[model samples]
Target: MSLGAEETHHGSLKPHDSLFRDAEKVSHSTHRGSQVSWMQTLSLAFQSIGIIYGDIGTSPLYVYSSTFPDGIKNNDDLLGVLSLILYTLVLIPMFKYVFIVLYANDNGDGGTFALYSLISRYAKIRMIPDQSAEDAAVSNYHIEAPNSQLARAQWVKQKLESSNVAKIMLFTLTILGTSMVIGDGSLTPAISVLSAVSGIREKAPSLTQSQVVLISVAVLFVLFSVQRFGTDKVGYTFAPVISVWFMMIAGIGMYNLVIHDIGVLRAFNPMYIVQYFARKGKDGWVSLGGIVLCVTGTEGMFADLGHFNIRAVQISFNGILFPSVALCYIGQAAYLTKFPENVADTFYKSIPAPLFWPTFIIAILAAIIASQAMLSGAFAILSKAQSLGCMPRVRVIHTSHKYEGQVYIPEVNLVMGLASIIVTVAFKTTNDIGNAYGICVVTTFSITTHLMTVVMLLIWKKHVIFIMMFYVVFGSVEVIYLSSILSKFTQGGYLPLAFALVVMSLMVTWHYVQVKRYWYELDHIVHIDEMTALLENNDVRRIPGVGLLYTELVQGIPPIFPRLINKIPLVHSIFMFMSIKHLPISRVVPEERFLFGRVGRKEHRMFRCVARYGYSDTLEDPKEFAAFLVDRLKMFIQEDSEVTAQNEPAERDNSSKEVPEAQARLTQTTVEEEKQLIDREVQRGMVYLMGEANVTAKAKSSVLKKIVVNYVYTFLRKNLTEGHKALAIPKDQLLKVGITYEI
Candidate 1:
């Protein structure tokens, strides 16, 4: 069964409420109620930024340290640390993410597929606007346009066509993301919870380490347990807490930045990044890979595209997001210079001793909150994918109608919970998981970069200089991140990749299996010409042989092409084949089902016809459509009024009673009656259940066919609806199938 879009019907409304509403066109808030000032939007954006952008937002802790270990070994590399921090926060986040991907966000949704759909749709329209516009442009310009509108139009059309390849790539990324994020999903709560619990150990020196893990486990159990209570409510509370957390990091960052002047200001320079790669050689690029740790959560932007408004995300990133990240990282670089001999993580360790434990607990809580973005993101992507026919339907509960993206899956949550705890147990430290984290996200980001490059070249009329420079910078950054994680695979990073492989393989297999089954069914179509020929002037109980329908036909020869001629002719003779050749771009309509016949012209013995639906009619289902055609044909042959006009004139000589009898017979044509008889015959095969109709398999091949049919029936039963199964005797009688009645 196909998973179509939900109708989302509304039933009733409360007092002073309308159930029917348009969220995009109709404003929810009254103009008199509030203006939603920029500062207020910024404040809301800050809160949302904390919730949506926490992963990348928290990167200052580890990324700079990971990058500038060489600087730490020496006392004076604060410049290098500052440089890396500046480029990462002020450049990467500011220029690359905030200015680019966010701007490319599709129709307020940000992700590869959403952007793909948006750019493709709009690009095509803009490419070939109209003749009046083309002429007006020519008059306005002294020179001809550089590119033909039609050429650009074809280029985009081809790109959109190539998008199936892009979809597969995106689906690959989705699975990769779900696996890694799920892995992170499991570890986040455990590490965050245990670290928080561990903070108490400093306050209470006698507490055992086992007690910490146990309490951590208990907190995780509870945290995992309550996800069914939608995150929308929790996020409202969590977002503000997270924002304060960012502010804390910001305060500490500025604290370190104000006093230290080891070229701390120069960290804002982009040349530091250029020099880091240039002077340090390949090791510099390799080490700089850890810089991805800062933007690791960038992919979360794509994953969580469905959750927040694109405008809100933009406001958050350029305004609250980048500035806070810049401050924290600068603080971290400054902290290292003063305490090179012994450094704790700059995020927590930068704070004074008096506030250490409290801040540590706060940091851990922030990480748990960070986990929420990915957890919620995975649920949203999977749910939307299922609705779009790219995934299987899992049981999903939409927890917040106000926020359609906030969904809960008991199965998904439970699995994430298990995977997260296992990760905490496996790695035993935040550093270990940190290395594990960036690999999945950066790979996905890299793939998106590649996808967007294709989109730009084929869809957007972007300048070559811009595109070349864009790829060089972005691709190099992604390659650095990927290489950095290669060191971690031997430790624990490969687990997510290995897990992702399993999921990607499963998705590919299911899609192929469905395609095979559908094509086989489509190939067996019986043409109307063949059916008409099968029924010529015969009064017979059975055809006494299986019907053979040929699919392929050669040109001309009255379309009694070789395949049709060979298979549908003179054997048992009551056979048909419908050849439907569809153009990849055209729609197939019912009125196009017509015959091109040779053999059937003389005696209506065998026939061939075509159903003119094109390849683009991708939404049509084989079995359901076949059933629909049967119903329409039944009405047309048995009771349609048109046959009365021609036949009633000749039969007027008969008496009124005789004329009525002939009319009844003509209304129910032999071809329509024969189809019903064949359907009944197939249904009668079910009698093998009760030991009736026990005729032995005749041909050597029929034995395998019978067994295959039996297996198919069993599998089909599992996939069908209860109502559909009820119409079949197998489930109704509950006697034919091997399964027992469980009353």
Candidate 2:
């Protein structure tokens, strides 16, 4: 496929040149080292897919057995189930995922961050677009910052950039995705293990039930132990493993249909659904209790978007997975109808006892793989979230390809591990746990459809009518699924539902707290046009000297403009500047570095400046980024220091000069020396806000003690990780409110 002039090919060398920075000593940055082979790349992708698809694959263990009303509905109803399966695997995964989601990847990175990066490039990023930057650039005519395609794109993409609005939206989506997934992750293993163990009982009619329990425990333990290996290996085998699974099911289903002959054809008819519902009425609505179980893994498919190319997943579905599932359901229906008295355990009894144990083992293997898929995807997503600051960073090891995001989290493993074990012990088997699985899966699937709806409308700009048509179809299917799953509420289903609710709540709360803290930090650095004027009019303290602050986000303007204006407008007097460079997540690759752009402007002397980063930086220190600005800033205009040997600045107002000659200087100093210097006054800005305390803000606030708090809070929020939240929890218990005022 051809790419646009502005769009680089997916395999283009030095892809991040237009972006901010290359990876900087990041744990798993792929751009840092030796080039990998195509085979290696394929391996990585496959592993990622495996880790992510585990839950979806194992759904067959219950979906076919559970989708219809008890005692066989016939051919017609079976066809509908088959149709749904076909469309789900073939159409949805193909169109929405393979064609769209995978193509939407930003620099090979997927998830909200990939979308955020792409959109951030084009969205308008300033708090407001029209402001003071034009004159300032005009004044510092020699300070060459261009309005390049990259610069314009950054603002254009600001709709979901690194801002409060974007973070919140992403957080909401992640919570929805993770909650349902965690719900399934906890239950899939138990069901798979239990199902496998129970099959052994059929072979040895008198086999002690204790053996089943022992087998389950042993298998679960082994599954848990192998998690660190990642999903790649299992992912390769998934297509094949699941291929056997479907074949076995289809063979059984087809055999049953043949035995039942003409009567079996009735099962393929839709009338069975209508007639069954007509007679059962409320009872059929109640039978819907099981119909939803058929689609338990849909949401997990969405959550695993980053793990596999949409095409691969869709191919797996349409080419093979869906047909087998349909056959299995139809077969189950035929067998039950042919011999009504033998409805119970029909899926197993129809087959030989020898085959039952093997099927059980295969099913269990499929389950462990499903669980691994979820586990790894979670690790990857959380890793990206940490770097993006949606969540605090945790210690993560890369167990797969060095994508920086293909991570291993011991803590996450432990938590999920312990919880899954507890749940398995509580529920005991697949039949018991199946109820909870569908509820979480369907609920999350419904939410993904909603998110996909938004993506189509805003991002893709699809027509409203077209979007709605798809929405209605998908939504109806989900509603049907959801209604049936609701029956699970009375069963073990409440566990996953409650688990989802709790996980979502915590994710939302953390996002809220992150936003609040961001606002407080903004209060420290910003100066509003109106508020600063009012302060100046009222004889408020004069902010001294031009102060510049370095910020983490690479954008047109800081997101917390309101808090910035509210807290610091009158606190300083000099031309204040806030600067951020677009930093990429990969290592420096040379051709992509060295940027020049100006995005936003406020009244007085405050200006927004951005610089893009090059790729070779994985080995280089990023602080040198600020140093680069200082070097380039020297060309802004003849330095006032050069113009007036003694007191040039007193009369040389910035209005006369084209650009404020930011005096940021970088000196090569040892860590202890740099720390000591910052200990006195940490460097406040990237270009010239060198040193700790903002000399301007400090002079403005003579109270002294107040400045200390601001500095401390800034220091901690930037440096602290999520693990620190546990420390703050105790303080919150002692105090009714959250940790708003950092000591």
Candidate 3:
């Protein structure tokens, strides 16, 4: 086992060399401190109002009309519905999300993946099995494991990590939440834009329903077309228009409260909520579906947490969005009580005649802004999904280098735009669009509540009594809304569910097949000992330069290499097996990005480099990656030398004073020689070898599985961004080794 039989070796340092006793220390720290003036903080809060609160702020346009579609029965009905709206606005968005859920962010990143990251760190319920200790060291994965000394904490962690069922359940729950958000992405644009433009019919009564649809479609086309410029440009433009819209609504509401029925303010009492529910019974229960719209974009409070700090989002919501929306809803109720027949188009009709056209113009702009936020949200969710391995890899373009979350996916943008047009044309009314919107919104809310409860029990380790109390309060309210939305399934409610099912099916199939394919490669991977013998065969020609063989196997040599050797009968002078893994954490520190080690033995001239990344990390360019690998390979060589020296015996006497000097000279000489060798080897350039795997099910597999694997998953795989392109690998130096397998 010489590294190269013809090449002479530098004298090897024996064990007990004082200079090579310890390995290099690699320390990781996740803390970062910065100072910001209040002026800067205030600027961010203003921007956050424009970006984070758009969807929720625009809810006033349709909530009242959606609730009383058939028109208000009497003043008491208006009062009751207004009371429900007032309390819901207070309970969910203003209280729970602003004060509580925003605090549960993963290193300032939020959404389903953030919660999953938090929970996975404390327990062993990570669905992906290839996770490493280095992966857990990512900044966002900074949560410490539960203390084993506590019996109850240990029991919960064991239960969550030990059971296969728990892993699947947690993964499924996250997928459902994400899928519903995607559904909202599609529904929100259609409903928001259509409702906005529909205001035109009040002024121009001659305009047909088809005309309104065409106008909405045109608006959406413009919105989606400009998405490539990214939200950083559009977000600032939207905030001022939305701020003015909120002020207009608030001012109009106050005017109507004085001029029409100031007594409608009595709806602020909780007793009306109870009396209304008791009087109307099932009718009032059913209207909960519409009332839920008041908190339509509440999830954005949690979903968009990555874009801003908790304090900024809360300030935007509490200081601006909450009061304006509440006043607008109450003003609509006041106007409706004075003229009960206007309930069908309460938002538009309730406006004072003098300011109707101006308000209508602002409403359209606000709706467009709301749709923009949802579209951006959908892209973010898809990007995170791809990183988590739940979805196929898509082309993700970062619109702003300064903000990691400001991304745009061209494919998703096109799909959402098309879905919006189809829904707007088919539904022809906000009444139907609202039906679909309520279902998606309530379903997502329920899913978040469930995930939060699990967080409280497992990660937060709250007392069972407090956990149950949370469930009884928020969970019970969400369930009621869910029931109400379920009743409208035949109307437009089926739309979001259908969208969710399609997206969920795609994600589930891709993940299942990917896990299976990975396991198959693992079970059949080639061990280094077998490959070493193949390398020594006289029939095989050893070529110059480095071969960077890329594979998914984190530990062993890929089977593709021996297969490649069998065909070509040639090997490179240096072989480095590389694997890039995306962890479920939000971000990985640059210092801990690469993990280097020997393949088997040093004389083999083979090494392994694992380039680990978190979901939020941007991959380095190809040239940078090559340089990084070479640098880390040098470190690995040094660490290996240190470990070997500590294991072997020393040549000099232990008591000799000159022994330290002698060891230092030997260590420096050996390191210099090794560095020269590495420099020479690398001068010949590097080639990247990657496998193009074709996967299919076995003949004995079930028809459903075969269809899923060979058809659905294959389709997705073919359409996604290719590995080399995504990695920014140079085309000239790239080599593809194709392999086919039946799972």
Candidate 4:
């Protein structure tokens, strides 16, 4: 009774007017040929500049001013900062991310979880055990076969799987990375907007600091207010603005190079980096905290890969972003060499006097677009986390059905908006926000290096020397940046660390409770034979309608079944034990998404269906899923008859026809009776059954266990959206059975 190839059309049969109607026609381009049309390539690259590169592109707004807050002291200091900025940009974002990290993309999706998905396929490190063998056929579940290096890879896999400490360390590192990404959603808007609006001071030197903060806060208010409208609209509106911004800044840079001191170009040599560091000494080391801002939004390159293709993103970066940003930085340095007094206002002062007003207007627009990218990335991370069961369920609105990744979580949007406003008002300057921003940026980069090394060993199967070389090179670079940022802990650098700790706690607690709940059901699992024997007694009355019982267990009968029968006297005539599971992949194909089987013989009228989805798959309402299941059940009966007919022998056709005629009569009678029962039951309606558990620590447990389980986990469970609401179950047809559990 499997819903494999035969039930492929069920998704299209959904109502055309449904909110997620476009999800039926999922735009799966993975299987298409490598060669895309020129128009598609161009459009994708253009949109990539708007969505993928906004944060990095806007880095020029604040990097220079932050590096020399008290103003550029000498030519040595200026050239040194420029050299560090140039090499940092070249090493981290350009060489590391562009050439190497992008290759580690998971089935075209990229992020911490995407890397985790790739690593989990070859190791036993995953916490959730819901995935079944049939899940391997999902379109995105890809892993290369073990080859000549199989022995070495297997050894590493065995060591990692058997060790509890290693498993916990890996999980902690991955969650901390994801939490920092969410923290970026709060900090990017604050710094980018404030830096752009700071240009107002150049024109009106009389404007007080409070006036600047007020204007920046007002712009942030408008930015977050329109977030509910979603990024599809925002992307289209900002693409042209960003395109113009790049061209405008590059033009200003070329003019500045020809007009101001051209000797600033000497900073391109690595010698200046050595000379600058040697000259500035300790001050040069401390300033790496600010210089790292040159590559602030580099993570967006990997995080936003789900929205656009790799080739398109690469083209956008190489062809447009790289040259434009380089020219802008060089042009600012040239202006500084001529008028050292203008270091505090490098961007606007460097601009040709006639074009300052136009560039200022464009800078504000570009900054707003940059904030949108971070906000969208945060939503994507949380949505994926929820699917993996690490985060509690929240309302996920798919703003654009054409792209499954374009989502909006209203609760997240409100909180992020409020946080950004608080940061803008409280910090009141990009210098301090830059400190907090540098901490998050460097920490995320370091985590990426660690995860990427794991991918190299498990998935890529690189040689030992190659892995060692990678770790030595990238690991040292990230460590230095991290040390520099941590040195400023007292000056607004503690904010991102505080945010990450809070988010990590919530994720850890929710995951702990979910894993505990699954173990409890496994320990108390029952068998369907118990229910069959009770029916044979003929002591219990059978009700009419169908019953859909949800459970966490994939095999055997869930403990709740017996608990329900004990509490209630009767059961529905036809029953389905259903379980929904998420696999470690990006998207699951429809034909292989449902696994159906009978709980017993045909006479039992009981069945089991497991609905499977990938981490990035769109979830359907429970009512829709139920309708599809029933249609598949009807198809199963017909398919069974076809199989029986085909197996009949040709030599005994005459005799076989007679037997089949009688058998068919009996089968027809049984099917007709079942259909009549189903029709009559439909008039009475169906009901959904679920259990609501109250979890607390065992009596013998220590105080720490009580606080974690009975306090923290319990509070999250109650505060978060309930399972029924998340599944979109109809209230009139829902029944919640309550129970208590001690862990």
Number of the predicted model whose TM-score against the real structure is largest: 3
Q: On residues 400-509, what C-alpha lDDT tens digit does candidate 3 reach at each position?
A: 87667878888788878888888888998888889899988887777777778877777676777877887789888889998998898898888888988998899999
Whichever of 2 and 4 has more lDDT, that candidate is: 4
Report per-prediction Cα RMSD to one decimal: 13.8, 12.5, 4.6, 5.3
Off by over 4 Å in 2: 1-54, 64-171, 205-214, 231-239, 259-271, 300-308, 339-346, 402-405, 526-743
Comparing 2 and 3 on TM-score, the stronger one: 3
Ranking by lDDT: 4, 3, 1, 2
Instruction: Please list the C-alpha lDDT of all candidates, in the order they appear.
Output: 0.51, 0.48, 0.78, 0.79
Give a tens-digit lDDT track for model 4, residues 461-551: 8888988988889899889988888888888899999989998998998888788888887777664567667656565667888888898
Model 3 spans > 4 angstroms off: 1-38, 144-149, 655-663, 676-683
Model 2, range 274-343, lDDT digits (tens) per residue? 6656555665565554555555554445445444444444555555555666666656656655564444
Per-prediction TM-score to the true structure, in the order listed: 0.62, 0.62, 0.92, 0.91
Q: Which stretches of model 4 miss by more than 4 angstroms?
A: 1-35, 145-148, 534-539, 636-684
lDDT preference between candidates 2 and 3, better one = 3
Which of candidates 2 and 4 is the stronger one according to TM-score?
4
Clashing pairs in 4: none
Clashes of 1: 5
